[model samples]
Target: MGKYEQLAKDIIKNVGGKENVLSLTHCVTRLRFQLKDEGKANTDVLKNMDGVVTVMQTAGQYQVVIGNHVPDVFKDVCEVAGISGGEGSGEKVKRKFSEAALDIISGIFMPSIGILCASGILKGVNIILDMAGLIPAASGLGQILAGAADAMFWFFPIILGFNAFKKLGGNPYLGMTLGAALCYPALQGVNLNVLGFNVNATYTSTMLPILVMSFIAVPMEKWLNKVVPDVVKTFVVPAVVLFVCVPVGFCLIGPAANEVGAIINNVIQGAYGFSPIVAGILLGFLWQLLVMVGCHVLVVLPMMMGLMAGEPQPLMAVVAFPSFVQTGAVFAIWLKSKNKKLKTIALPAWISGIFGVTEPAIYGVTLPNGKQFILTCVGAGVIGGLSVLLGVSQFTMGGMGVFALPAMIDPANGSGSIISAVIVAVAAIVIGFIIAFVTYKDKKEAVIENKEEKLVKGREVICSPLNGNVLPLSEAKDDAFAQGLLGNGVAIDPADGKVVSPVDGTVMTLFPTKHAIGLVSDNGAEILIHLGMDTVKLDGKYFEAHVKQGDKVKKGDVLVTCDVEAIKAEGYSMITPVIVTNTADYLDVVEMASGTVKAGDDIISCLN
Candidate 1:
């Protein structure tokens, strides 16, 4: 089986099984699901599952945040669930108009975002190379690179039509045919007169025309499917769909949508033309907020439209500074925070933000601490205003963060715009770092016990939770555990089915599946005992918990019991990992036991 196959199966089972899913789609870091009944999902269970970051419900999407590897998980979910093209039949839930619109936009745009970013980066790189005199604009290599960069935008209508039609529950190939007709070379710059009405428009590289066509085609295809006979309906429906949609798109939808797009572009240009700095400040301050709520797509669609029209996009340029700003805030948190757990989250989040992906920074670090997030926004606004004042504008859509600098280099203006971009980026980081470092304060934990009076002093021992042969965590099957992403630990190949408390502490987290338990020792070592690899998929069938969350237990007290033979019969390995989840808080977590052990024996030592 594939690496994520079990994870995918577990996810599908917890989300009310495959029967409850209406559709499944994904973005860079999330699996977006449209469920037939949201109430049926075991949300808490999924949240506690390994490999999952968090769960969110917004804009009618049940979002499973899965980090950067979401695409792989998404694929496995589709395959394991037998989902074809993300389409499933179920009763529709009543939703607000705004919610419905947001859902549709996310469904249509998110699937293609990766390729769009890649193409934009390629275009930006080509421009940078040309400006450096490494390649002339008219050279064969430059021309080839330009074609590769421009292909996605030039054929955007086809891509949009395919996704939009599928999202609307219509035949996608018919949508593609309509988009092709709109983009046909011979039809460009054409004027057609029908019944004394003149239809004149250019449709290549446009979005609205195909979107409108997809909307109209859904109902049209539905009606045709009902009236036409079954055997011939296969060929007939498509033929009729293309025949009607192509003409209506060219004569009516194409001209009207193009006009609307032009009006939107002109209005945005007029607003920026009035006061660029004000526009920049507003976008910079509010952009991350919009992303947090999943509403950024509304702004992105228009910006993409403007870019395809060969217009300079200052709005996108202004918004790009927030990633660096978020990074700066994370750096401050990493440098100043005493909480080891928060520091671990901050460091990776800071690295991700540099690459222009700020979700980790926003969700993992800054937003949880309100002051840093606000400071980051304030820094972004200040830098954004400065960027516009310095005349920084993007001539093409590009990758995020520092990578976006190349797109700001306007060949006609030499390197002046790119220089301004660099200045804005550096200023954003500096301002964000200073503001957050100066203003941010870690919340003081309420002291429950006097540290000096504790028996353990600056050291603690973790007793064996299971009677088993000890194994280094490096030899474990899962990379997350083996590599210590979940924290440093040692694994045990269990010889018994029972789990005992290794320390005197309260239960910190107890998974609904009974396959994992988290404990916080009185001496402050946070430990996690995961029952087995991929055992969460058993859904509590072969496991039982002796204690609930928040229960206090002494060392050697029974915490959980497992049906070892039954779990193994079902193909799950019974190797449990006893991890110090907050390993960074201590100087070292030294494995003390080697070959075999009894439940009450000391297995590891935590030194402070």
Candidate 2:
């Protein structure tokens, strides 16, 4: 069996089974599923599953993010379920027209961002080589390599057309055909008289022209699909769709949309003229939100690409601020978190966010706490505004995060954007750290209780905190507990939500969310009882705490009472995890029993 075989099976089961999957496709990090019925799938179960990062619904598709190893997992998932893979079915669902357009644009362009950055890096490398005299720009070797790097951008219309057509549910061939006509060599610099008006347009390396033409090709292809018979559909569809779209494009949409680009550029420049600092701050502050709603790609990414066609794109410099801000906030969570669940998510999220992925941090850690999310914006905005005012510039289009620095390095002037970028990143981290530490205070009793618990010598046996069926920690749903990453533990599917003290101990810490508690036994066993996964979002509405930090209790003493049905009704699980948090302090933490248990029953045996 493959490593992810069970995860694949579980994911398929929760996503309404293999029968519910109409078709499946995967990008670098997510499983894009076109489901027969979106409502039938259990998003909560999928979100809490091990080996899954998070679940997102966007662009009329149910997306299950599987992180960097998604390709291999996608293959096993298809093979296990007898699925014929490739996403296409159920594409007719309607969304708001503007939102639909943004979805189509982002879906097509996001896949190419990796290659776009790679090619830009190569172009930057060539320029550096030429300037340093290590290689001659006029040489044939340099020319071939440079063309290799430059070709992806120069022919973007065709590349974008192929993906865009798939998104719009049109014949991709027809879309590519129209894109090719826009870049036909014979018409490269020609001005044509159409409809008693002269039109001059060339769209080889442009942004708007290709997008406008591709979207227009969508409805035109749909009309032709209905009229053209399947007997000769393959050739006839492409021929008719292109023949109509190409002429109409050059004569009408091209000229009109070309002027629209100029107008948008003018509007953007006018905004920047008022205060470049304010524009930078706004972009940095809202970039993550824009990405969440699927607008950043359509609005900001294209603008930078369009600007890069002629000269340096300064906007690219400010956009990099969000990556650092997001990572910094996660770093703060990692440093400040006492809840092992939060700590586990924070560490991995911080690592990925540094590399320019924010979904995990935003969905799993920061966004759950309103203050944490706002702090990221504050840090990003302050630094982003200062960067623009200091004249930080970028010479090419590329990736985000630390890798984006290559584009900012201008050998010609040595403007120190690289230094400023590093300083800004450090500032963002510091600001984020302060916000988390200040906003979420540590439990006051932890300091007082830890001093006494440390004086005890031997390990202590802990009893069950609830009347429930005992489950191995591996079955906890959440990876932080399931994988034993938060130390040795056991879990429960509680019959009732009454939580009691497992040992004669002091309550070391009580979460503000009222969903978790920490205790240290008199004999020195440090334990954590965490309620349902991600239940902290409830903010204590369904839970009533009978004890506070530093309160003393014996076995079977009720610590809290919760309305379990309220949690379940609100789409959260009722499985509870009981973990020996300070596992390193003992020789070994062992589970004493499994399968069935009652409150005060023996469950965890800690050895000194």
lDDT top scorer: 1
Clashes of each: 0, 0
TM-score of every candidate relative to the true structure: 0.82, 0.70
Please give the RMSD of candidate 1 to the true structure: 5.5
Evaluated against the true structure, the overall lDDT of model 2 is 0.73
Residue-by-residue lDDT tens digits, candidate 2, 1-608: 46777678778877888877766766556787767778888775565455676677876667888776787898888877786444434435555686455545556776567787887777767776776778766899889988987888777777777767766677666667677788787776687777888767788776667678887778877887788898998788788777787888877887777778777777766777788888888887888776664446665664665544554655677887687777877887788867555576678888988777777777667776666787788777887787787777677676667666666766466337656666776776677667676775422211113542322234467889999999878678777577454557799989998999999999987766688888888887778898887687688879999999999999888998999998999999889999986664665576667777899888877767
User: Model 1: how far is 66 from its true place, Å?
Assistant: 1.1
Residue 42 C-alpha lDDT in model 2: 78
